[model samples]
Target: MPARADFPYYDGRPVPITGRGWILLMLSVAGAFAALITIPAETFPATLVPASLFAGIPLLALAHLTKRHWTALFGPVGLKQVGQMFLFGILAIIASLAAGVTVYLLGSVAPNPAVAGMGAMSGTAFVLRLIPTIPQLLGEEILSILPFLAFLWLATTHLRLGRTTGIGVAIVSSSLLFAAAHLPTYDWHWVQSFGVIGTARVVLTLAYIWTRNLWVSTGAHVINDWSEFSFTFAASHVPIGTR
Candidate 1:
C-alpha cells in the first residue's frame, strides 16, 4: 500500500467517506443542479449564493469528518503556486480553444448558442456578465473536484481497482458528468456539450489530477472561460471591414 504522502494534496490524513456521505453528496449535487435550471435568470445571480452554500457546506463538513484539512483537499496556495496556476490556466485555455476549433472544423460542433449570445453583447455588458462567473466558476470546481476525489476513493477501496485504472475511471466519469451538466446551457447539443466541452473537462480534470490542487484546476477553468468570453466580446465590438 502506498503511504498517504504518495497521494496528491496529501497532508498525512485519512479521507474516508461513508455510504451516508455518498448519499449526501448526491443530494447536494442534485439540489444545486435543480436550482441552476429552475431559477429565473433575472434572479439567477442571487440564487447561486444559496445554491453554492447548499452544494459546498455539506462537502466541507464531509472533509472535516474525514479528517482532511482544507489544504489537503484544495492544496496550499502561495505566490509561487498562484504563478504556476496562471501558467496552467494558459495551457488550459490554449488546449480548450484548440479542441473547440478542431471540433468546429470537423463539423462535430455547431456554433455555440451561449457564446453567440455573448458575442452579441457590448464589451461593457460582457464584462458585467463575467463578474458573476468568477464565483460561479469556483462553485463549479467545488462540485466537480469533490465528486472526483470521492469517486476515486470508492473505486480504489470498494471496487479494488488498480490505482491507474481507478484514476482513469474517476477522471473520465466525472468529466462526462461535468459535460452532461452543461447540456441545458448548450441547448442540449451533444456535439457541443460532449464533444467540445467534454474534451475541455478532461483537460481540466487532468490538471487537478496532476497537481492535486483545486486552485490550479480552478485557475485553469477561469482562464479558459475568460479567454472564450474575451474572444466573443472582441468579436462583437470590432468593426467589420469590407472592401
Candidate 2:
C-alpha cells in the first residue's frame, strides 16, 4: 500500500522494486523465522539455540554476498565503529541497570512491590547466560531489516531515490513495518503500542548514523538482544510460547 515516492529518501535517481524481489525477501525471512524460532522450539526438533546462530550467521552472509551499501542497509561497522558501539552499549546497559534499581527501590518503599525476575549469580555463570538469547534477536532484527533494505535498494535502482533519502526512508518505513508486525505477536493495540517499536528503530537509526555502516548497528542490535535474552534465560522464560 505504501508508495515508493512517499519516502524522504527518494531522489531523481532510478531505483527498482519488482514483485519478484519482494516475494523473495518475504520468503527468505519467513523461512528464517520458521527455521530459527518455530521449528527448533517445536517438540519434533527440540534443539537449544540453533535459531540464533542459524539466523545471525546467515543474515550477515547475505548482506556481504549482495555487496550492497552496508551503511544504508544495516548501519556501520569498522574499527572506529566498534569503539562507538562499545561506548553506546555500555551506556545503554548502565542506564537500564540504573532504571531497574530505581524502580526496585521505589517499589520497596511503596506497597511492597511484587518481586519479579531478579536474582543474583556468580559473575562467570551470569555472563554465560547470554548464550540462550541470540536467536530471537537475530531472527527479528534480520526480518525487520532485510526486507526494507531490499525495497529501498530496488527503489533507488528503479525510481532514482537518492542515497541519503533512501536511508532515511528505509529507517522510517522499516520502523513502521516492525511496529505493525509486532502488534499481532505481542497482542497489543497497534495504535497505542507502536511507539515502543518506533523508539527501538530510532536507536538502530542512531547506530547507523554513529558509524555510517550496518555492521555496527548489527553488533549493537546483537548486544541489545543479549541483554534481553540474558534475563529471560535466567528466569527460564521462553516468550514465544516455548513451542
Candidate 3:
C-alpha cells in the first residue's frame, strides 16, 4: 500500500466515513442544493454574500469533521505556482469555450441567456458584481473540493475500488454536482450547466488532483471566472452591432 503521504489531499490517510459522517455529508449537500435553488436572480450581486455563507458553512464543517488540513487545502501559492495556475486556468477556459462552440455549431445547444444578459450590465455595476465573487468563488471551491475528497475517501475505502478508479468516479461525480450547483445561475439550462460549466469543472478538478492543493484550483477558477466577467463587461460597453 502507498504511504498516506502519497495522498495528502485525502488527509494523507484513509478514514472510513462513519455513519454519522455520512449523514452530515448528505445534509451538507442538500443544504447547498436548497440554498442554490432559492437564490433569487433579481437580488443576485448582494444575495450572493448570504448565499455563500448558507451554502458554505456545511461544507466547511464537513472539511473539519473529515480532518482535512487547512494548509493542504488553502496553502500559500508561490510565484511560480501562480504563473502555472494562470496557464492551466486559461487552458481550462479555452476548453470550455471550444466545447460550447462545438455544441452550438452542431445545434445541440443555444447560447446561454444568462450569459448574454451579463453583457448588458454597465461597467460600474459589473465591477461591483465582480467584487463579491471573491468570497463566492472560495465558497464554491469548498463546495466542490471538499465533497470530492469525501467521495474519493468513500470510494477507495468503503467500496474497495482501485485508487485510479476511485479518482475517476470522484472527479466525474463531483464535477457533475459542481455543474448542477450552477443551475440557478444558468436558469436551469442543462446544456450550459452540464456541457460548459461541467467541462470547466473537470479541468479544475484535474488541477486539484495534480497539485493536491485547493489554492491552485481556486486560483485557476478565479482566472476563468474573471476572464469571462471581463469579456462581458467589455462587450456591454461596446455599441450595438459594432464588431
Candidate 4:
C-alpha cells in the first residue's frame, strides 16, 4: 500500500485499509445499508437508531483500522470550518438550483413526499424531525466520502490513473452512487435524482476535497437542507392569493 496526499483519515495513505481491512470496511458499509432498509421505525427518535447504526458501523470499523484514531475523520470544527460550511453550502445551493431548473425544463420534477409532510407538522414535530436530520445527514456524508476515497484508491492504484484523472473518476462514480441511493426517495425518478441531487453532491464533495474534513461537508449539508426546510415551512403558510 502506498501513501498519497489527497484523502485524509488514512494517515496520508490512499489505501490504508488494505487486504482484510478493506473487506471489513465493505462489510460495515453493507451492514449500515442493511440497518437502513430493515429497520422498522420510520419516524423521529426511533429513526435515529438506524441513523446511528448507519454511521457507527463503518466508523467503528475505521476506528479499529486506524488504531483508535478514527476521530481524524473529523478535523477540528473551529470557526474556520464553520466558515467553510457556509461557503460550500452556498455553492451547493446554487448548483442545485441550476440543476433543478434544467431538470424542470427537460421534464417534470417529482416532489419529495417527506418535504410535503413538513408543511403539515406541528412546530414541535417539525423540530423533532429537524433534530434527527442532523445526525442522519452526517451519516450521509460518511456514505459519500468513504466510498469516494475508496474509489480514488482503486483508480490510482489498480487502474494506474494519474491523480487528477483518478480524482475525476472517483467524483463521478461516487456522485452516481449517491444519486442512485436517492432513487427510492425520489419515486424512482432518475432524471430528478441524478440531475438535481447528483449535481449537488459534486459541490458538497468539493468541501471535503478542499479541506479533507468531514465536519465541514456535514455542516454544509445541514445548512443547505435546513435552509430549504425552513423556507418550505414558511412558504407553506403563505396566503393563497399572495402568489
TM-scores, all models, native as reference: 0.82, 0.57, 0.82, 0.91
Return the candidate ranking by TM-score, descending. Answer: 4, 1, 3, 2
lDDT of each: 0.70, 0.53, 0.73, 0.83
lDDT of 2 by residue, 30-76 (tens): 66655654553522123345566446554554544343522234443
lDDT tens digits, residue span 123-188, model 3: 666776676667667667767776787778778877888889989988998999889887767667
Taking the tens digit of each residue's C-alpha lDDT, what string does model 4 give over 35-141? 87689876778978887888888898888887755766677889989999999999999999999999999988899887888898778888987887887788889
Model 3 regions lying over 4 Å from their true place: 1-5, 8-19, 36-45, 63-71, 108-114, 239-242
Instruction: List, residue by residue over 26-118, the lDDT tens digit for candidate 1.
Output: 566667667655755643357456545544664565555564454565677788767766777777777667877876887755565666788
TM-score, cand. 4 vs. native: 0.91
TM-score of 3: 0.82
Badly placed stretches (over 4 Å) of model 4 are 1-5, 9-15, 239-243
Ranking by lDDT: 4, 3, 1, 2
Q: What is the lDDT of residue 215 in candidate 3?
A: 78
The TM-score, computed over Cα atoms with residue i paired to residue i, of candidate 2 is 0.57
RMSD of 2: 9.7
